[model samples]
Target: MSHSIAIIGASGYTGAELIRLLATHPSFEIKALAANSKAGQPLANVFPHLRHLDLPDLVTWEKIDYSQIDLCFCALPHKTSQEVISKLPKSVKIVDLSADFRLRDPAEYEKWYGNAHSAVEMQSEAVYGLTEFYRDEISQARLVAGTGCNAATGQYALRPLVAAGVIDLDEIILDLQCGVSGAGRSLKENLLHAELSEGTNAYAVGSTHRHLGEFDQEFSAIAGRDVKIQFTPHLGPFNRGILATAYVRGDSDAVLAALQSAYEDEPFVEVLPKGETPSTHHVRGSNYCHIGVVQDRLPGRVIVVAALDNLTKGSSGQALQNANLMLGAPETAGLTLAPCFP
Candidate 1:
């Protein structure tokens, strides 16, 4: 129950979120907070909201000794995590919150990331961190890869259907809208308050977004064949939450039943009754996903909607879930907080 943990890239949005969750975690101690760019600064200076918590000051990654840390949460940028994780001691259990290890295929990782995976051997050892489906594998894993925020949302609305054969996997279409934080804390002209506040638009149209690799891997595996879905993600002006609407050919009642049956015993996923849809605000700031389904106007079609805070259930919170499994702790530990509603 006594586990020492470190967050490798502690200066970003997701890193701060992880710190907030682990602050309430009973079995773990936050031993190190590393941010190469913000070295020597107090975490309060970088993330003022977390100033209330007593935490380690930000330092360079090299200053922390992995020999003393039992688990590490890698919140580094896509290509950066591979480099940093490669150098860590093998004894440290890793829950990588980046795209680096989610794909088992090193060649596919290179294809989407534009660089060959330097830790190809380690990549093969990492387990996909989809907690519900990969529970057994992740519980015994030393290194686990968290899914993309958008990818996780889409799967929430559709994976059960694919596994139960309740929906037409070949015709599934996932249209997702995500909050600004999903884009990260970096400075981008389009993300400025002036430009992003008033409008919402879609990016990564067609099959171009990097998260498609995850959908391809997951959906195909569940159906026991090659199954691909049309996925498009939109950028919303809000600060948190993601709402994914998936259109599939299926019986509305069966889809609802499948979701409820799959997640009723689970802590994070909530499946609403038929005809009731979900809004992102309801699940905002919590490690919960609310899913609902209704009959589509087109005959034999159904619309499944799922909502979650992209930063919570989709990223950091998910990283913590996998870590709990990896550490033999309760899967829902430190993650039972109810959604914050106005």
Candidate 2:
């Protein structure tokens, strides 16, 4: 029962990652690869590392025969994603790797993204794509929205505790550092080697980061209250992962217990032992999330750390995981590869 697939925005980092992971998938076959700018060019032209695999040449999304695609991965940017997804055929199951559909409220989407959602109807039907927490919903959804890499990392560290009422919600603070690739494959002066390689600095400070909208939406829903965490994101001088450290006022033992209980059964999420800390290097290039819990020097304070590849477990890999469930295949079918460690 192999599922035929199409990847839109194929030249980007997440798009390439989806191709890389799907190349070895037991039940998924790439039927189309679309990258409008690179249309008519071989995938090798944009991604030389992928030259070895026999994949279709890049084509524009409008040229694809969606009738033959079992599922489509929309890896386009935010504002553009909503427009493109709104135009895609309804019969095709879509896993959108954009902020467009992650927030259920059209008003909130506009608040964070600065534009009214053009695909409000589809947005209403789109299930949030955080696999661990929304598995059943995703299995039944026709459209699923992938989460922000920084948001995903922070949630894996705090959602369980918030659900269990073991932490002080209002006092929570999440400080995250993500690799440059998390910004995407697009060009920007700040992302150049000379500007970014030798230094690290925090952007989206003062709780202004867009992912804060996700944190507010998800955490508040779990606690049944307005839960706003102080979030600040730093762009690191590397290429592939996200490390998030959450500061919370909770019993350390209880915090660990909550995380371990929530993810003990999840194949892709690994909760490390007490006092252990996770590193971006440990979970690079794989759909695996490593979490660690440690007691703070002061009692009742705890530090929770989570690490994962921003491109894999954060976006494209998450889209693939949800797609498997929507297609009735095992959730971990194409996602069992081990983390790429140093």
TM-score for all predictions?
0.98, 0.99
Say which candidate scores most in lDDT: 2
What residue pairs clash in candidate 1, if any at all? Answer: none
lDDT (tens digit, per residue) of candidate 1 on 262-341: 99899888888789999998998899999999998888999999999999999999999999989988888889888898
Q: In lDDT terms, how accurate is model 1?
A: 0.91
Give the lDDT of residue 190 in candidate 2: 98
TM-score for candidate 1 = 0.98
The numbered model that scores best in TM-score is 2
